[model samples]
Target: MELLSALFLVILTFLVVTAFYHKHLMAEIPPGFIQRKKLCFYHYLLNFGFVLAKTSEKLGLASEIHVIRTIMNTVPPLKDKHLFIKDVRFEKIKVRIYQPKIPTTGQRRGVLYFHGGVGQFGSIRAYERTCCYYARKSDSVIVSVGYRLAPEYPYPTQFEDCLAATIHFMRTAEDYGVDPTRVITCGDSSGGTLAAAVAQAMVNRKDLPKLRAQILIYPFLQAVDFNLPSYQQNKTFPILTREQILLLGLKYLNKDVTLLNVLFEGAHIPEDFQLKYQKWLSPDNIPEEFKPRGYKPGKIIHPLSDELHALTMPTFDPVFSPLIAEDTVIAQLPEAFILTCEFDVLRDDGLLYKKRLEDHGIRVTWCHLEQGFHGIVFLAPLGRIVSFQSGNKGIKQIIDFLKSI
Candidate 1:
């Protein structure tokens, strides 16, 4: 037994050392105010994930990835210092509600927050701290939607769950002392995708209370062109790599993983359809400043595959890619607050969407975190060792915008 234990320790040590070397050497981190502390934390997280996956295999788990995800998803204990927190159901979907304990003269502002995990991970319990912070600091009644994830639930289910919960909350906001008219839809990463889609979906609902604003923090707004400058620049950035981004989409859509390479090369989009989306998603829309980083316009792969396009059809819909929505729909969108990070592949998504919203004559408050990377918002409040200054500043910017509106 002692010999077996030593063998395990040696394997673990080897894995950590190799993973650290890959992260430090192979990772394509962009030039900016990169924080060593945050980088090291991310490096360790990847190493731990690798170790857990191997350990799960030894335990005869069904999936090594699933085992790793399950362990990481163990929710922390609730912190309800300045708020009354409750876990409730909105129709069929589950949601966590946070209402301030302090007395209010009138109905408080409402924020419907969706957490990010590329569609397969993250939950209200996982995002308890972030939601709690927003509710307490903003003094707004916040509902963190625990939408159903993918691989088990399938595509559009996440969107369906978010839309249902938002509708339920909007209809019953008064009962929770929330002013329906002042409500905002907010999210990060893929959650930002849902938040944008939900906000756009709400704009056409005559019966629902109009959302005052929509906040998208480094959202994955389109699938048409993954070869954007940001993708080229930060393809291997920690937390969310370019290949991982497409892999998560395939998982969420219930498609075969082998399709990842095809999708990555832009072969899943036809020539005509690609042209239709190009007007909105083109790199030409990106600002001149963002182009200084290593960015070469990639050639659209020839001989678009019909089967591949058919497999990825839903991704082309405005529901999935809100950035490609028509001008008419965009013009009707509520005021927007967009945050973009320097070292994030999804940076151009936020930048392009910002330009689209402003072009449509919609009010926009933009926050660019020059020193930040993807997943920084969640890292900020996790203590000095794991947190980034940009994450704290980004959250402050969101709160300030919420206050202004």
Candidate 2:
């Protein structure tokens, strides 16, 4: 009877979560819904409290990526110091720099920041506060790369742009009061993905100074298996979802939408490829403990389709999945400061990458937030919405790691 009651509660919570997500899911929200914009912000901010008070139980958070984005957009921009924002065209690529006036002793470390939005719909604006805070806290020079986005500037372009900007900075670090030797490459979300990829690429370039460190805040690492423990358990998580992930994959590659069905069936990756990469992407790679909440290895698809396999080629390329880089390259990487959230679908990506880094003798400083969800880092103290403690803690954790080095 007790077991039955627990199962019922889980089922009920899932029902509510799914219903809420679907309400905001329909490709994009219609403009008619804009009339309720104010209400929506309050609803999301007070959602957990609302569920607690009314249901006498905690309501699972909904994973509405665009909805959260829309709500965040509605907030009046917090007053920031007058930033002389300029887009400097650096040898064909463009980059935006943010600096606070305070001279450094020797040269300070230069941060090549990559913004995250699944390689789409994100810009320097999304991470305004973050860049500001880092500048004020670390007293370092911060350059936020507004790399090209998907469906607008497709695969390889964004990565190439980030690489170009980073290399240009390393060459001209002296002009910006930055030490070439102490530079860092960092980013969040898909930005974190870009940071890691750029870091690996830097390792191969003997022309550049070695990176001081790489800070990856819950980066999305692999695309081989969307059925990992984290994906299955947090399949419907807000801010990011399994369905939305596939959508972004298509958008990034400019792939045909008609193959979406086969893509979802694990058909995008062929049998031999799956077998070869499963060691790295498998749920088995994740520990048994992470499965406590809920996790089940998905059913295998014997025959995958060729049409589904085309554009997805970039998914496993070292440029996209730095975690898939060769061991020799991984070993040479700077020490890592990694942050992972228990409720995020990309949690396992971080975990697997952490393990690989450790296996390669790379020192890793890891901070895992058990109760936090994805995108909490971007929501610090902005009214009725309370910041996730882990987000702030995660930020401090990375700062601490950077300071230690």
Candidate 3:
């Protein structure tokens, strides 16, 4: 009885400390955020899980990524009778395929989806319902690519896996009753970065059928300037913060997290490269309406140090920063559907990419969610209690675009 009492006391103390930390986090949520109550609950749960995972990592019971991935992937596979789901490998890459059960008079459109976890911790299992919904609602064959993650697979492997899976799907799409010519590439967050790179890479492929469209949802397009208007406005917003983005990105590249400060300050960018990409990445490319939140041209605090520039050279590669791709490449890409959340740090990336595509004579369908935030669309599949109306609306916009093309 005494031991039980002592254990209970410890647990109570932990809970109190956690609650205090959570309160501090809650204070950072913006005033105009949608569904404040639900957001608070979600944030608390996420924060608690993260704390537990970190504790476990320290105790050597499990790594933090393993614990978080296990928790996120814990949702039981949906037993939806309306769709046929299968887990398969494409060119050694894991992927989940979702197809509607209903018979189709003609070949269905194909969609290759890449799940987002900053190239670290998302899986097809975590996004099961998302792909299922798209397949059923749009009557399309959805392939959710479970690309290899960072630290384990390292940088560019995720991009390579996504590109390989896309090529495999495009080649064998007929076997799955999908229209090869009507294939689309789509992803959110880091996944969006892959989709954009894959589409750009495919532009030069003379063999495979051209992609019908590319959809990027709140994608991180560049590492050039982190002080864009949206970045300033929503840097502290929930789900994803500016510091977290830089830290995760550094980890994804297998670089020292210590470089985050230099990267954030734009010291990792070379003067020559900055000059060449300025026209595409300039804040002036962003429209006036987006600046209403707050934006000031960032003054260069320091020149690029050769050591720092060398460490961040990969960030300038087109495969990593699709926004910096040449105009010739941009013009040859397929029509794009870019989604930007008003309260997302990466919002300007989408807006700038949209403008670049348009300037290059490529068609772009842009969706701006004023009340939405990063990772909102993923919540739509979690049910009414956790999902927001804005997320459902975003999903609807994606479905509508799929059907139109």
Instruction: Report the candidate with higher TM-score, 1 versus 2.
Output: 1
Model 1, 293-356: lDDT tens digits are 8899888887776777788898888878999988878999999999999889999999999989
Q: Write the per-residue lDDT of candidate 2 for residues 1-405, one digit (tens) a residue.
A: 999999999999987985675567532222333213333343354454333443432343443433334434453443446443456766776676766576546777778889877776566666667776776666677888878766557788889999999899999988777889988889888888989998898887888788888889889888777778888777765556677677766667777766566655676777788777777676777778898666766776767556546657777798877877877888889888888988788899999999989888998888897755677666643422445556667777766766665
The sequence of per-residue lDDT tens digits that candidate 3 reaches over residues 103-137 is: 98989999999989889899998889889988988
Quote the positional error of residue 69 for candidate 3 in Å. 1.2
Query: Of models 1 and 2, which has the larger lDDT?
Result: 1
Q: Mark the regions of model 1 whose C-alpha exceeds 4 Å error after superposition.
A: 1-27, 54-59, 62-65
Error of 3 at 403 (Å): 0.8
**Against the hidden reference, what TM-scores do the models get?**
0.93, 0.79, 0.95
Root-mean-square deviation of every model = 2.4, 10.6, 1.7
Winner by lDDT between candidate 3 and candidate 2? 3
- Per-candidate local distance difference test: 0.85, 0.73, 0.89
User: Residue 227's C-alpha lDDT in candidate 1?
Assistant: 92
